[model samples]
Target: MGSILVVMENGTGGFVDSSKELIAKAKDIAKALGMSSVAIGFGSEAEKNLKGLSVDRVIAVSNPELTQYHPEAYEKALAQVLQKDQPFLTLVANTTMGMDLGAGLAARASLPLIAYCSQLSVEGQEVLATSSVFAGKLMAEIVVPESGAVISVMPGQWPQDTDRGDPPIDRMSLDLPSSMKILQLIEPEKGDVDITKAEILVSVGRGIDNPDNLPLAEELAEAIGGVLSCSRPVVDAGWLPKSRQVGKSGQTVKPKVYMAFGISGAPEHQQGMKDADLIIAVNTDENASMMDIAHYGSTVDMLDLMPALTERLRGE
Candidate 1:
């Protein structure tokens, strides 16, 4: 059996959380298949990050063209690496860069592609990938071709690999094409806090009614010493920045306590917060989807509940 390959992505500090999840899953798959797990990362910081991950081999391609995300440059560099080291299965994160890179590589390399995977397993001679389709209402299991396959797994579905290791790095210097250059790396302005790292969150939704009523939720968050967060509708209405939004398109959070106010709980929104240790939902509609999955739910108007909760917490 060939090695299990985990294609990693570089982020602000090091490898992104999604990539870490893949590393853990890859290690498990490698153990099952009696094969070694190998990881490939780009840039010097990625090399530094890859060195600490618990994998059998770490392939680091440190080059200027590979530092930032360039579609052509990355594809070219990765293609060369793939040709040199043909792994049986390659795992990619279901993120923006990963999606593009995985699809492009599958097409260019003529490899079978399995995307939006929530679970992956090796059974006998076949590899199976389970994906959620129809906006996550249905599950589709696909059989990966045994020759070779590329898979993209959804983020937040698996536990992140945190074990540290000092793996030897195999450095590669590819003669990558210079067809494109990233002139300015414009990033979203950093928010007051990283919601993904917060332990407690007071999240508001469209049920808050007006933007002026946001103060109630903010006060409640302040009183509880939690960060103020919101659903997609709240961000779309300009009541909160996208930074504070929690949903499929936004950051996925696994806080110790997640308080949802007036959220109708669309499937997209639920995907982001379903993993919270404790979910407390308050909505006017008792049948709201959010209420069904919440640990504790109340059908009281959030407009009435926020201030009362805030005062009670402050008094205590």
Candidate 2:
């Protein structure tokens, strides 16, 4: 077994929180398996960010175009790196980018891919990956091969590794695709409260029914001093901003208390807020996925419960 390679997710000029999460997990696995952990990053942002990272070694593909996310270039670059190093386990964040890149890399490099990995451990030089299936209703365990495998770790499951050290930087380059270019990139608007930092979150899903009912959830949040969050459908419906959305495509949150109203708990949504201290899910369907993970679950109508909870909190 060689080293564990982590494909870090880069942001504007630094790594994202998920990037540190992968790094943190890589350290844990490497320590348990007696293997070194290597981090691979892209472009100038990564170059600046990778220097002080606490890893055995860092490989930075210092191409300017690689700063942002170029699917073609990234797949090709990572393919080349995999061919040369062949780490025992390569970890990538199961993000929007990782979902696409990991699949492509697995196909091109002929390596096994374990997606939606929530837990991993080493057993006699073999890595056992626990993956969530059927939107977290079931769990499947996968064993990595002797040759190697690619694993996309679910975000918010692991803690962020902030320990910094000067790691040796290995520079590299490749034939990046020139056909595709980003003409304009617009960032999503920020919300007032960062739900990730919120101690309590009142999360809504498609169960909220109509936009007019948003005030009901808002009232409940205000009464409890919690922030208002929603699932992907709410963001898509323009009922909430992207910053307020919690899921794989949205923000990952681990609040002290997570109150989910009308959310059916898709796997993506689970990845965002499943690690909360306490989960209270309210859905009409008793068999909803959220009910399985929630500490307290209710089959009562969300509309009816929202008002009652708010009125009780307000001492009405």
Candidate 3:
């Protein structure tokens, strides 16, 4: 059996949610393939962050320059590791950093790269993968034709590893080439109510009509004790923050209850919310695809129903 090398970002703190999910998927895939799985971390304090994983080993490329995430440094270090390990398959989380490094590695190494993979399985020498297409309206299965395949998986789509079995983390270090220089690091803005962890979500759409009309949606969300989210149009119209946008370009939410109001389900918007356990759509149009997929739906306008529902919910 060949070795499976899983790449971990090992961010400033511990591993990010996506990286943790990658480790979990790597372990599961490795077990299925009957091969050993190892997690490779590239950061200055990687050992402190990645030592908690249940993997067989944790390889660190700890250097001061490696602390901040830069495309050049990451590509150079990871490419060297890939060449050295020569594993059967390399797995990375489907995040901005992971995708960039995965693409760079694929180009430099001339390996088959599968990006944004939703599902993966091993079939003999082939690593079969499935990607959601047409805004997650369809599933397409594919196989990497190259010997050493590189795959980047989407976060929150896979579960994280919790169990710690035998064969504790074997810490190994790697020396990197001093060609690349570390530059300034810029921190991005943070979002409120990280939708990835929220079990309940109340999503609004164009049905609300105007920014002034959002009080009702807020009331519904308040009654339900969950944050209010919306479609791209609502966020684009300044009715809500971009963080609250739920779609392919926005956040992918897998909430326990995804209540959609006035939003005609577009493929791009639906893809992000399709994983919700129970979907409820409030739309007058009965023929809407949202109603078809929604476990519960109402034919009346959310505008008319909002006040009464809010009052009733408040009364109860």
TM-score of each: 0.76, 0.86, 0.71
What ranges in model 1 sit over 4 Å off? Answer: 46-48, 162-170, 191-200, 206-227, 247-255, 262-275, 282-293, 298-316
lDDT of 2 at 97: 83
Global lDDT of each candidate: 0.84, 0.89, 0.77
RMSD values for the candidates in order, in angstroms, are 4.1, 2.9, 4.9
Candidate 2 off by > 4 Å: 31-34, 162-164, 191-200, 210-215, 222-227, 238-243, 252-256, 275-278
Query: In terms of TM-score, which candidate is strongest?
Result: 2
Model 3 spans with C-alpha error above 4 angstroms: 165-201, 206-227, 246-256, 262-278, 282-294, 297-316
lDDT tens digits by residue: candidate 3, 1-316? 5678888875656677777777787887778877778887766677666666788777777765676666776777677767877777888877767878899988887788877687888788567898755544456799866587898887677777777644345454545556666556544223766766777777888889989889988887888787788898998888788788887678888899998988888756775898799999999988676886799999898898877787888896
Clashes per model (N, Cα, C within 3 A):
0, 0, 0
lDDT of model 3 at residue 187? 42
Which lDDT tens digits does candidate 2 get at residues 250-296? 78889999999999998899878888999999999998999988999
Per-residue lDDT value at 136 in model 1: 57
lDDT of 1 by residue, 48-69 (tens): 7788889999988888557777
Backbone clash tally (model 3): 0
TM-score of 3: 0.71
